[model samples]
Target: MPGTYPVPPGGGRGAGPATVPGDLLAELDRLLAPSVRSLRHSCAVDLTFGGSLAPGSRDAITIRHLDGHLGHTLRDLHVRAGYGLGGKVFSMGRPLVVRDYFNTAHIVHAYDRAVAPERIETVFAVPIRAGETVVGLLYLAQRDDVAIGDRIVARAVEHTRRIERDLAVGVEVRRRTAAYDEAATRDHRAVADARRDLDEAISLVGDPQARRRLREVSQRLHRITAGDDSAPQPAADGVLSARELDVLQLVATGAANGDIAAELGLRPNTVKAYLRSIARKLGATNRTHAVSLARESGLLP
Candidate 1:
């Protein structure tokens, strides 16, 4: 919430994409692989691994990622909150270390079977957090019984900070994307409602000139709420049939063929036929183009 995401590959986080790709869990994993690779190469840590909290729960940490494991002993490891080193880190919201995991008295050995097969002696864990909540764990392990010095801990924390920033940005992106989608839905429904009300008013008007004026006002409303952004060209000569004009109105509102069909009591195939007819009359190449040209020729609002 405090900072902005650097523009990602496809667009900026503020640009409001539909959803954060792969959700929050996958965002954690995205940065984890590179961090693990860097940690294993940058320092003497024989093993580097991490896991995100399973979505919707903070009681368990599932490790699907690791580097330098000789066998599959630690693959997809599950560590509960407050039990193993990772659990202690999760529960305390801080880092934890053990010179000898098998002999450690500082934490319980709930994951002894998982670690015994790894033959790892020194184990270090750091909490990856978003705001005040611990969202994940990062682990550093070695085969020798040795103290994890402050130097390595600081480096590990540096990597953890990167992960923290990534998670925070991911959270913001998800929030923004959801808000954008909701606003779009709200706009869509509003256009439909306004169109319905305006059409009802036009039907009640008995005077021909007043009815025509009302129709022009309706077109103006459609243009404001629903027109495309693309530049327009002069419309072609042929006049669109009434049914084709009806189809164009819904198209301007960004309705799909199925929705347009249901709205006008036409079949899906009939909607498609009307769209083709509209395009031909307007000299347009596509749905958006048809709407733009119709607006250009004062055929649509």
Candidate 2:
């Protein structure tokens, strides 16, 4: 009996690094502590996870300040575009500071309700970018200071640099995960196509004996494509001959050159030739790519 495709057992897709960088947050607290050292002030960081604004808002100014306090809890109050401090920061990647809490022309008054309740005085906002992409903003506020100086702005930028590094790492991890997901999706589509071919073969063939054999082949192919059939199939790209396909299948299933040689009843040197030939036929630069393509094309399950 034909073996099933080796399905790497299903697990929920991993969301890369659920919690933000603890060390970075610690560093931020340490760095910002000096700025607000005299009177207790809070430092907050907020970001856009690409989708909609959580509750705090999407507009950068609102997201930076509002979410920092409430942690974006109120979906209804989410800042919209070009409305508040978050909006200004979103548009301008630089930092903005207001010494006196009550008066700032650089930003909108949309956050006045929340500010009035919080009794906020002075506010500073800075845009945090992952490279050129402005993902969110950072805000620091103090009720006493009417305006902050250059030193505080410099420290805030330094803090941003550290946080940006962490955010970049997170972005790279996400990119790799997305690439894997795309590859998996492509493999699934290929299997569906192969199954359709098998079904057509079984349906089109004539004679009871031939039809039974075809049906069996279809069932076996279905099992493999659906991840039930055991053993990986040979890699074929429509270019490889049947013998070449046989040679590659074993290679992909962790067979070494000599082991493939033994299985195919060919000399080790001959197996090497077959591998080279198969790679050329499949337009694969190396064995690994060849295997991946084979798997994706339903040449191997």
Candidate 3:
């Protein structure tokens, strides 16, 4: 509680206190070759999220690659625990190799469908890690009897390391940015509270002359709070009575009192009475000046 900072609504340590670093997911995807991208098109490599992972969840996953013009991405992932090739590598936190998945008696027989549809004769699954945690797994496979060499798996692991480093940097940037925004909001609120306290103290003075001076100061403060500027101005448009509007319109058009009375079917004295009321409401001088002031203040055309 000693160093607590007030955060604005929906703002915390993640809001870019500094400029956002580059997106790591896009960078990692770019490092992948076209062949890898095509193969991974079916894989569930979710790079669109940033946050802590759930207690028992890994960050990403891999699925088998299909051949021919199936022309569809992979869906319906079948996951197991240390069972099939992908599951074994995920649980052991080590790379797995199966030359012929159907013949692999050492690993569980689950995920047979994944291997069968892809015609996988040889496959490799390597777990991607952040520090000691296995964040995800990557799979490489060929449909025919060509052996998937160890070199390709090594290269994939190197890429994973690069992605992990970039991801850590981005996470740190987000955390620091959130902290700075929280501090700024705290400082602003403290300033606002201090101003409120000062206003309350100014209202509490008791001596007659002092009270009178304080009341004047309070009225000034109230004007500031209410956004009122003390200038000799017309009332806001539409604030005048119907008679006041008729008088103001005649004045705006430069009509004489006799002409206005004739136009409005009123006595000249009645017109004069409405004119005085309009002038008083608009804080204006006499007839000629009232018209000028009304036009200037936007109450009359």
Candidate 4:
């Protein structure tokens, strides 16, 4: 049975101002409001979001948002692990409900001070997970002691799952943005180093012809490094399929037909057929000539 646990003064309530971006929080409110409304119409009257803002802390889930009449009482409430109905759901990583909150032996009554004011008798709590980690808790409550049916529980789970997906996508977008910024910094440094090396080489070279050739190569490298540079367009006469391009890229690396077949999960005969078609498209007589044509056409780096 769940039992009441002590909450530190001014601790078991919503933390200070939100750390999440305002836009993200607004978007979350927009996306989640409909689900809460739907749940209210179909199952329960009150719905609250206890977001896991501080994963490292014992009292991680804070009641951040509410969507019903009981909002005034439940707002800013914090639920720690293994305490209260929401905490039990968070700690257990599952959904739970009680027909009568005060009488139920499955959950602690530590939250009665807040819940009693709201007159919430029946309540359901579901854990919202981003991948394997529980990131939030969703609660559905009502003023009566009516039992929450299985369909309502399933609906609550489904709604929470959608929130989990959005949270995961936000996390992935942040990770990719950071990675791209790091890569751009590295590229800038590499371009600077290459320019310095070219200047040094030009100074050391005595031959006029060699210096001119180096200058030409440097100009080409600069063009390649420009952000506006686009991939070479294929010939107007023929367009290669994606699979053919895959095979051609492998051929550009000097891979044999058998090696290409193994890498592409195709038979050697299929590899030969692709090569023949590529040769025809490029007007090349053999595989070696076909590779040369592809390089000249800027089809492969």
Candidate 5:
């Protein structure tokens, strides 16, 4: 996790929050709201909201991903540890339920002003975790005091678990992509070194034939395998320029704009311009979608 999410300043998770992969957080922004919607639909709940421990947030669980929300009740609400229903879950690392949210003696009314707007009653809060790390949380609520029974609990857990699995996969992909890039960089350097040496050798040769033979070898050295030369790579569907392709490749690895700019020797603003163009040409709604579209279009490997 190159962009490690720091733990909530000395108060949230005692041992420090888990270093969530930036890819996982980005994926959550793309994936979690849909998961919450599905759960709400399947369970027939009145309201569903998904929350993630966003980067740079110290102790609030107010970073709702998207629209599973019923109203503006929870907007601008920062539920910290030991406060609201969500904060308690973040602190306790376990699911909690209240048959009547306002009347319950179990949790505080920190978000009461906010929660009051939805007129929500019984609420079920589950920690959206990957292994033991609590990356985020899922909430299921209704306007009435529905029984916080096995069925509701089971449904919420199952859906949240799927989200957890997705988070895990995103983290794994981030790890593998970084590893692959590191190896590829090393191989590139090796190829460059070999070609430099070959060029030096070719220059020293007296015979034109030997020099030509060495030059041919030097040209082929950059190819990963002999088979790569046999088939031409598919032309990018959008005909993305070389710089655009470079930006997208880094995007696929979940690199932030600053990192991508640094790698490509461009200004941050220039990187943003490239991304906007990439998104428009690809018809991609977001960064994650752009990478997916590029891969599907065979514009990326």
Candidate 6:
């Protein structure tokens, strides 16, 4: 029900062309071709990815790539939720098939103009979901009334799962990149603020002892604000191993121990050992303090 709605054509927020990359389209084309062959379908197959067209409107799935068929009607066609065969799949977030598209009373023939010209009688659609959200649909079709068997459906589902895994990974990579960028910006601001405060303190102080303490603090902050080349290197003493550094870097990115283990191909226990070693080397009482010391000591960037 959430992904089912129909509004005027090209009237939604994403009315323009979707920002799908060429490499992803190419990969989808490659995967679709093999899937059609493996399913032993004599007709054409294509992939349509769903994206938001406007706020509060259901996402429309558009034909991005096809392995077969010459009709321009099917190409670039936007399928809305609860409208046609693909729409039903999009709304339900699962696989659906109509042996006879025109004759089927189960789904509305909203896109008969496109389907009739293509002469596609049977259609099978599977939803490609990333996490809990359905992101796209994969379709296998035939020009004749052929019953889609269980084996073919199963194989198509498997391919959709593989595609979903790739999409999920891409999403995670983008999220982490954004997080790192925000963190870097915050670190720069913190360094500038520290320098400004130090300058103000030195100017305002009249006592000789207090002035010396301010200078010491200024020197410490300078070491942190300066580039790694000017700062004292931590690796020279071999205090923290390369593996421990790897764990700390991910930890600074807000990764849990389990995620660090998965990323570094280590056990959870091994990740804990690395963290303990890093904390001991930095003389930090906790993980947060350890990360602070690492950044200050030029062990992390």
**Candidates 5 and 6: which is better by TM-score?**
5
RMSD of 6: 17.6
Query: Candidate 3 at 103: error in angstroms?
Result: 1.7
Model 6 spans > 4 angstroms off: 1-56, 203-301
Q: What is candidate 1's TM-score against the reference?
A: 0.65
Query: For residues 177-244, could you state the per-residue lDDT of candidate 5 as single tens digits?
Result: 99998987887787778778876776677654454445446545634433254432222345678999
Give the best candidate by lDDT. 1
Better of 4 and 6 by TM-score: 4
lDDT of 4 by residue, 194-223 (tens): 976985787677654465455445544554
Off by over 4 Å in 3: 1-78, 202-301
Alpha-carbon deviation at 156 in model 3, angstroms:
1.0
Write down the worst ten-residue block by lDDT for model 2. Answer: 1-10
* lDDT (10s digit) by residue, model 3, range 1-301: 0111111111111111222223433333333333245434333221111122222334324333222313233333545446676666656666656666577576787767644654556666655444565544456665555554445545655555565676566556666887887886676566446546754765464443453344334334444444463733443332567777787787778888899999999999999899877765555558876665455445566
What digit string (tens of lDDT, one per residue) describes model 2 on residues 1-301? 1111111111221112233343333333333324322222222322111111232223322232233343344223445445565455555545555555456555677767755644556666555554444444455665454345556656666666666675567556666887998997788788778878876765565554454344445445565556765633323323567887898788778789888888878998988888887765554558887776455445675
Candidate number of the best TM-score: 5
> Which pairs of residues collide in model 4?
14-76
Q: Give the candidate order by descending TM-score.
A: 5, 1, 4, 6, 3, 2
lDDT sort, best first: 1, 5, 4, 6, 2, 3
Question: lDDT tens digits, residues 25-124, model 1?
Answer: 6778777888887887777788988887665565676787888988787778877787878887777777767776787677777888888878988888
> Which regions of candidate 2 are displaced past 4 Å?
1-86, 104-110, 130-135, 146-155, 162-176, 199-220, 229-301
Q: What is the lDDT of residue 8 in candidate 5?
A: 17
Task: Please give the CA lDDT of all the candidate structures.
Answer: 0.72, 0.52, 0.52, 0.64, 0.70, 0.62
TM-score computed on alpha carbons, candidate 2: 0.44
Name model 5 segments beyond 4 Å from true. Answer: 1-19, 66-68, 222-301
Better of 1 and 2 by TM-score: 1
